[model samples]
Target chain A: MITVALPKGSLLKDTIRMLQGAGLDFSGFLDSSNRQLQIVESSGRAQGLLVRAQDVPVYVEYGQAQLGIVGYDVLYEKEPNVAQLADLGFGSCRFSVATKKDGPYRSALDLPPHCRVASKFVHSARRYFQSIDLPVEIIPLSGSVELGPITGMSEAIVDLVSTGRTLKENNLMELEVLFESTARLVAHPLSYRLNVDNLSEYVDLIRQQVLVVA
Target chain B: MITVALPKGSLLKDTIRMLQGAGLDFSGFLDSSNRQLQIVESSGRAQGLLVRAQDVPVYVEYGQAQLGIVGYDVLYEKEPNVAQLADLGFGSCRFSVATKKDGPYRSALDLPPHCRVASKFVHSARRYFQSIDLPVEIIPLSGSVELGPITGMSEAIVDLVSTGRTLKENNLMELEVLFESTARLVAHPLSYRLNVDNLSEYVDLIRQQVLVVA
Candidate 1:
């Protein structure tokens, strides 16, 4: 049986709906009472592994799951060896540099050299700074990058901004947009190339549905 | 005002209770309706920044928070440059190497060389395997590590086992215990040394109360 790795939060509902549209019913993962991480679809042709968004590519890269649904931000940060099959187009967001609204800085380049910028996406933040020829320390924080500016731990933060509400509520403003991100369909490179378990058939069906929705 | 970094999940309740015992009432953090990540006590002598357990040390080490509460597991993994002040003696758990119950390996040593082991605590796992003179590829996963062995992604998983319920339910068995962990009180080294905002006074009060409860 073919296996699909599904992200657990934020993107899960849309992912489940997309899978259903593709003739796979792994909706049991959406049930609050169903605690199982691995669930087989109604027809048992495909199974779903409910995992973290960051972990989606890992499962697919390791060949544990032939296909995965993950965010572009995670793929950019992790740089896992996986085939980019399709852009599912939901879960739109962006990586941006944010700082205290009342702080001196108005743009990414306005900050002084070596000023710390906290972020969960350290690699992406580093690359962005390097591309701009600016020197800044990227503090790797697992969660709540907005707190970096609020707590005075860092001069700025590089984080995903969804609605701008979180940054506004925390008295932070986006100084620069590094990149736009949306959920994408990914598959194991070898599996996709070899068409393991007729994976291309499922991939084609999912792609068709995603295109219709987009 | 003294700023204390309080962890957001699992340890928050006990940490708040401990602080209350020390005459700081920051229990507002526990109120589900309170959406604030940072809250001030009624008297406002101190404020709390609620953050992820791993980020607690980051806040404190950067001197944004003079004091913080976090799990020893995180400290062991991150190895942040903070002074471990006191063991709060709560949120007890252990790091263990676990594998499928029906798998051939019965112990960590039984696993083949260069076998894959998955964990959120990659540093701790690496240190353990090194100390044991074993070579294993440690896959760092952000969440739901129990799915590692279940999905055939890893030969074993190094994860915290509290009640062993998660592992048991997933048909895995703990083969070896790496270490025991509990909540710990930490302080910024410079802040503690300088006694900024009379930080020692609060630290002493909390330590004394923890001793009484322990």
Candidate 2:
């Protein structure tokens, strides 16, 4: 049996629908009140594990689930040892460097070296700053990176900007975007290599469906 | 005037009640639909900033908020430069080492050296293992640490357990508890030292109220 790790929250419906299109039924997850984290399909050919969006790769990496669907942003942050399969092209968002709307700095380069930049996406923020040869303190905030600028705890913030509304409501402006993010398919390397339970066939099915989605 | 950072979540109502008992009115925050992040008290002598439970200290450490109330677990993880004035004594929970109820090992010591462990509280996990001279790979999971053992991603997990329902539902058993956690009163070091905005007086008032509650 192939166990698939699916993320919770936005994009969940699409993922389930996509899988349904591939003939693997996990539609039970669509029920809002369903508390079951692990659900087995009626056919027992494949099972589903519902988990936090950030945890998709971890499950797949450990081979608990042969496959997972998660965001590119999570991929950048966790950097789990898993095979990146195909881009599913949904959950489109972008990473950006932002500062107080009234702040003097208009760009990432304008911030003084060693200035504090708060972000939950610390790894990605560090990589971006390092790539540009900018030395800045990356303060990791699990929630509300927007508060970093408002509280004067940091000069700027690096975080996912989904709708731009959260940033605008906080009186912050996007200074620079790091990258566009989309959901991608990932699988356990060993499982893929061993072709456990016709894993390659299911992978190919999803890949073709993803192309259809694009 | 003193700016206070109050955490949002399970203990928020109690924290506000405690503050009201100290004769500082911030009842506006009680409105379920209130959209304001920062609210000035009716008397204007104190203002409240509703922030993520984890970011409480960052605001205080940077002097944005003169004082903050946060979970002790967060204090242990962040270790921000702030004065731990008092323990408010509510929002009680525990940090524990847990695994699938049917797992082979019965205790933390029973786990093999360098065995994989997942946790949101990575620092505390590292410290606990190091103190006991047991080496383990601590994976930092942002959410749902219980999934660690279930998905076979790790041998064990370290996370907060409140009512233990979540763990029970997931069929995980607590192997060992590291420490009990409660909400704490904290202040910026300089603010407490310099008595900024008569911070010490308010701190003392709250401390007295806390003692009365005890």
Candidate 3:
């Protein structure tokens, strides 16, 4: 039995649609109740675990689930031991370096030696700043990265800017784009080796569906 | 007027109780409408801003609000520019180091040179481990730190453990305790200075209430 972990919000609808297009029926999940955590498909050969977007990779990496659908930003931050198969072509966004519109920074290099950059993705934020040889203090925030600059808590912020509306509202501007992100189909090594036949069948079906949409 | 940023979770009830005990009537907050973000006390002298537990300090430090009620764990992690006035005495929990029941680590020192420890408080965990000279990696997870070690995505996790039930059920064990946390009344430095007369009155009232319980 192959278990698949799916993100619970935002990308959930599209994820389910793609799975259904691949002939994996999970209409029972439409119940919209707490009991829908586990969904049994029409074929009964696969099961889906609906979990938080961040927990999908954790489930798959621990072998609780053989495969997962998650964003590139999360994968980079977590550095989980999973094989990236293909981009599912939805939930596209960018992790960018942003600062107050009136700040001294005009580019990554313009950031001060000990400046602070706030973000929920602490790991990614730290690495990106360090890679640029810009010594920075990474102030970790759970959400509302825009508030960081507005409150003068950080010199800038490194966060995912989907439409830049949040940044604009807070008077922050994007300085540099770090990574263009989209959701990806990921698999665990053990699952790939052990359930090659069954996994490939499902993978091929999903891949063909994605190509059709493209 | 004194602005108070109140946590919107487990401690919200006690927070309101304390305010009422101080002779400030804020019963309007009990109505529980998500849209009612701000509420003015019946005294018409005090107002409340409903925010996430972790964001209490941010609002206070930015002078958006004068005082805040938040957990000690959050205070330790954010280390914002706020004076710890009184321990309000609710929403208590401990930031504990937990790992799989039969995992390699027997103690914090037993962790491998590069073993990853997942947590939402990346800075807090990093400082704690570094202060002890432990060469461990920190994998920041927004929530559900218990899922990290169980899923093999991290060697251990640093997270809040109130009853330890969640960790036990997930097959994880407490390896070490990092800090004891409780909700506290914190005030901004400038607010404490500028509104010393009124702020001291509010502080004294809360202090007396805490003493009665103590």
Index of the highest-lDDT prediction: 1
| lDDT (tens digit, per residue) of candidate 2 on A176-205 | 999999989899999999999999999999
Worst 10 residues of 1 chain B by lDDT: B35-44
Model-by-model DockQ, in order: 0.83, 0.65, 0.20
lDDT of 3 at B83: 88
* Regions more than 4 Å wrong, model 3: A102-105, B1-5, B13-51, B55-67, B72-85, B92-182, B187-200, B209-214
The 0-to-1 C-alpha lDDT of every candidate, in the order given, reads: 0.92, 0.90, 0.82
The candidate that achieves the highest DockQ relative to the unseen native structure: 1
DockQ-based ranking, best first?
Answer: 1, 2, 3
- List, residue by residue over A1-214, the lDDT tens digit for candidate 1: 8899999899999999998999999889877899888988889788999999999998999999999999999999989999998999999998899999999988899999999999999999999999999999998898988888887789999999999999988889999999899999999999999999999999999999987996
Chain A only, candidate 2, TM-score:
0.97
Error of 2 at A192 (Å): 1.5
Note the residue pairs that clash in candidate 2.
Answer: none
lDDT of 1 by residue, B32-110 (tens): 8998888888888999999999999988888888899999999999999999999989999988999999999888999
Better of 1 and 2 by TM-score: 1
Off by over 4 Å in 1: none
Better of 1 and 3 by TM-score: 1
Q: Give model 1's docking category.
A: high
